[model samples]
Target: MPSPLRLHPDRLLPAEPGLRAIARELYAAVRELPILSPHGHVPAQLLVDDEPFRDPAALFVTPDHYVTRLLHADGVSLADLGVGRGPLTEPAARAVWRVLCERWPLFRGTPVRFWLDTELADIFGVTERPSAQNADALYDRVAERLAGADYRPRALFERFGIAFLATTDDPADDLAAHAALASDPTWTARVAPTFRPDRYLEPDRADWCKAVDHLGEVAGIETGDYAGYIAALEARRRYFVEHGAVSADHGHDDAVAEPLDARDAERIYRSAYAGQVTAAEALAFRRHMVVEMARMSCDDGLVMTLHPGSSRNHHAPSFHAYGPDTGSDIPRRTEYTTALRPLLERYGTHPGLHLVLFTLDETVWSRELAPLAGFYPSVYVGAPWWFLDAPDAITRFREAVTETAGFSRTSGFVDDTRAFCSIPARHDMARRLDAAYLARLVGEHRLDLDEALETAVDLVDGQPRRVFRL
Candidate 1:
C-alpha cells in the first residue's frame, strides 16, 4: 500500500506551545482569505478558451519547470515528460507519471513537495503519496477529475478563491481575451492585464529592432525615430490601462537605471535600429530606458515593478533546445544601492510612481532593498520570488527586512508562478509561514495579538491592492 498522505494543520507554525497556539489562531483567521495574485505567468487566454487541461503530465510536468528541472537532474529527458512535444496521449502521460512517482523522493524537502502534497490530498482527494506502485491509480483519479466540468479552468479558478489575477503580456498584444473577460457578465471577477515591455526596452537583444517595429505597428505609431518609439510604448500602455491593467512588469538582467543625454540616447537608438550599436552603447541605452519607464509611470497611473539579478538562460545548449523559463535561470549577487542611484535620485520620492523592487539575490535584504524602501516613499520591497520563495528564505526575508522597512512598506505576497494548479497551495503555504513569523513576534512581546491579526489580514489582501495601485 502507498504511504498515507496527511497535511498537518499546524505544519508551519512555531514549535513552542505558546507560539504555536498563537499562530494557529492567527492562521485560522486569515487562512480562508481570497488570494490576490498581482504577478504571475498564467495566461488570461486559459480562461478565455475555457479548455480542459490536456493530461496529468502536460498539466503537472511539462508546463512546470520547477518539477521538470529536478526530474531532469535525475536523468529524465524533457521529451520524456512531454515538454515541447505537444499533446500527451494517455499512455505517454501515464509513463511520465510513473517516472515522477519513482523519483518522488527527489523532492523530499522542496516547496514543490509541500504544494503537491496539498494539491493531491486536499484538491484531488488522493489518500496516499505518489509512489511507483500508486502512479497509475493517482493518474487515473486526476484524469477523471480533469474530464469533469468542475475541474475546468474557470471552475477551478473560482474554487481556488482567487480575488484578483494579473497576467503578463507583451507590448504588442491586442488583449482581446482581456476585453472578453471584462465584458462577460457571467465572469464579473477581476482579471487584469499587466503591460510587460521587456523586449522593446533592451536594444542589444537579437530581435530588438523587429520587436520595436511591431510595437509601433500595434500602437499605430511610426517608430522611425527614437522619440516616436517612446510614443509608441506610451500609446500601448494607455491601451492597457483602458483594458483594465493597473501595473507594468519589468524583468531585466540587472537594475541599472542611469540617465543619458538626449544626443547620446538618440545616437544609440538610431544605431541599434540600424543594427550597428555596440554592446556598451546598448547597455547605456537600456539603462536610460529603465529611468524612462519610471517617468512614464509617474505620468500614467500604472504601478512599476522590477525583479532583476537573474542570470537568465544560464545554459545555452538547453536554451536552444527548449527555450527560456525552463528553470535554467540562476540568481547572482546584486547590489542595488549604486545601480539604482540615477532613478532614485530623480523620482524616488515621487508620489505618483509606486516602485516595487524584487530581487533573486538574498544578500541585499538589509544591505540594499530594505534600506532603499526605508528612505523612498515611492519604493516598496517586493515579496520573495523564484528561488527564494521557500519557507526558510521567506522567514529570513522577514527577519532581514522588518528592522529597516517594516511590514507595511513591503508589497504583499506575489506568487510569481506559471504553474496554475499550485496557486492556492502556494498562497496557503505563505499564509502559514507568515502566521508563524507573526506568532514569534507576539511571543517576543514586540506586537500584540490584535495587532498581528490586523497586519496579517492586510498582508493577504490590502497590501497588494495598495502597492500595485489596484
Candidate 2:
C-alpha cells in the first residue's frame, strides 16, 4: 500500500504544544490575507497575457530552477526533465512527472519538498505521494485541472489573493508589456516592473560593451565616452520611472561601493568599453557605478536594492550549457561595513534616498547588516534571500536583527521566486514562521499577544507594500 500523505495542521510551528497552538491561530488569521509580492522574478508578460499554462512540466519544471536543480542532482539529466534543450521530443507531461516522482526522495527535508507537497495536496487533491506508479495519473489530473479557467494565470492570481506583484526588468527593456497590462480595464490585477541594471552597470559582465550599446540605443544617448554613457543610464532610469518602476535592483558579487574621480572613472569606462579592463578596474567601475546609482535613486525617487554576495555559476559545465539563474549560483562570505562606507558616507544619511540591502551571508545579519540598517537613514535590510530564504533562515534573521534594528528597520518578506504557483506557499511559510517566532516572544513575556498579532498582520500585508511604495 502507498504510504499515507497528509499535511500537518500545525506545520512549521514550535515543538511546544501551547506555543504551537498560538502559532496556528496566528497563522490562520494571516494565511488568507492578500499576498503582497513587491519583489520577484515572474515576468510581466504572464500577467499581461493572462494565458493558461501549457502543462505541468512547462508550468512547474522548466522555469523553476528550484525543482529542476534538485532533480538534476539526483542523477536525472536536465534533458530528461525537459529543461534547457530547444524542446523535448518526448515532452510528454506524464514522462517528465515520472522522472520527478521516481526521485521524490531527493527533495526530502528540503523547503522545495514542502512547496511541492503543498502544491500537490492542496492544489491538486493528491493525497498519495508522487512515485513512478502514480506519475501518469497525477499528470492527467493536473493537466485536466490546468485546462479550466480557474487555472489560468490571471484567475489564479485572483484566487491566490495577490494584491500587487512586481516583475524584474533590465534597463533596456521597453516595458510595453507592463503598459499593456495597465491599460487593460477588464483586468484588475496590479502588475508592475522593477529596474535591474546589473548588466549595464557591472564592468565585469561578459557582455558589458554590448549591454552599454543597448542602453545607449534605448536612452537615445551616445555611448562613445564615459560622460555619454552615464547620461544614457540616467535617461533610461527616468524612462523606467515613467513606466511605473519605483525600485532599482543591483546584484553583484560584493557590496563594495566607492566614488571615483571623473578622470579615473572615464579611464575605467574606456577599458570596459574596449573589453580590456583589469579585475581591479572592473571592481572600481562597479563600485563607482553603485555610487552613481544611489545618486540616481536620490534624484528619481526610486527605492534602491542591493542584492550582493552570490558567487554565481559555481558549476562551470551547467552554467555554460544553461546560462545564469539555473541553480548553479552559490553564496559566499560578504563584507559590508567597509565595502559600503564610501557610498554610505555620501548618501547613507541622505534624506531622499531609500536603499534596501540583501545578503546570502547570514554571518552579517547581526554584526553588519542589522547595525548598518539601524544607523543609516537610507538603508533597510532586505529579507533573507536565495539559499537563506527558508523557514529556519527566516526565523534566525528576525531573531538576529530584531534586537538591534527592530521590526521597523527591516523590509518584510519577498518571495523572489519565478514559480508563480509557489508564491502563496512561500508567503504562507514566511507568515507561519514569523507567527511562531512572535508567539515564542509573547510566551516569554517579551511582547504582548495583542502587539504580536498586530505586528503579524502588518508583516503579512502592510510592511512590504509601504516599503516598496506599492
Q: What CA RMSD would you report for each candidate?
A: 0.8, 1.5
- Alpha-carbon runs more than 4 Å astray in model 1: none
TM-score attained by model 2: 0.97
Clashes of each: 0, 0
For residues 316-385, what per-residue lDDT tens digits would candidate 1 score against the true structure? 8888888887868889988789999989999998888999999999899988999999999999999999
Q: Which ten residues in a row have the lowest lDDT in candidate 2?
A: 85-94
Which tens-of-lDDT digit does each residue in 8-37 have in candidate 2? Answer: 888999999889878887888898888888
Model 1 alpha-carbon miss at residue 292, Å: 0.3
Q: Where's the lowest-lDDT run of ten residues in candidate 1?
A: 81-90
lDDT of 2 at 269: 92
